[model samples]
Target: MNQLPEDPCMQEIQRLRADYEAKRARSNLDSAGDRRCIRLADIPGTISGDILRLKQNLPDSVDHGDHEIIGDKVRPILNPPPPPELDDDSEELDTILASLPIVDVDSSKRFVKKGKYKSEIRNLLECEG
Candidate 1:
């Protein structure tokens, strides 16, 4: 009697079958309703308003105090301040200075008298050596 040997096509079918089974198992493990959506709806609109008010009142570097929920349980939440705005005049100056290269003006202009000054300096250095 002859038996069928495992081939590339059979391997591919087995891989697909395993993937389908894994997906089915995951679907079974998932909750009936997504908790994230439910949690978002449960959060009070007043809390969002408080966050906006806190942001408007404080500078970027400033730290807002922890939020405390009073009642049955005490839950603390931290809120950070918004980023500060850059001043227009200082920002413009920074941009302009960033574009320029540093150079020594006196050294560059010291040899302005034709090519004579450069040649003289070279000769003086040669004699000294």
Candidate 2:
């Protein structure tokens, strides 16, 4: 999950979220205080006109790129590379097994039943001698 995408553009987009979050944090820090707020009622006429003009200048929403182009662009996303053969932080099985502490069990040691549990015996028929 920590690895970047193959496409540089995607990598850039992925970074944008974190970058924007950080910038937002810094902006908040810089503007900390009630004094920094711009009240809508307090905004003078000229700045408000400029804001209106900017809003008017914005183009109407239009259909994006052609479907074919869109499909092509999303193909990589739709079909991603197979997951890594092994995770980056994962140790090799051999090394992991080697690192594990060995527990030696004595072959001669045998478990004996005790307590309330006991083996059941079947009655055998007695033969006339």
In order of appearance, the predictions have TM-scores of 0.20, 0.21
- Candidate 2, which ten residues in sequence have the lowest lDDT sum? 117-126
Model 1 residue 116 CA deviation (Å) reads 99
lDDT over C-alpha atoms for residue 89 of model 2: 52
lDDT of each prediction vs. the true structure?
0.37, 0.32
In the range 1-129, model 1's lDDT, one tens digit per residue, is: 222336666567667666766655544223333221111112334533333323112122213233333222224344424435665432224433343455454432233432223445456457757
Considering every candidate listed, which one attains the maximal lDDT?
A: 1
Q: Clashing residue pairs, candidate 2?
A: none
Best by the TM-score measure:
2
Task: Name the runs in model 1 displaced over 4 angstroms.
Answer: 1-5, 28-129
For candidate 1, report its TM-score: 0.20
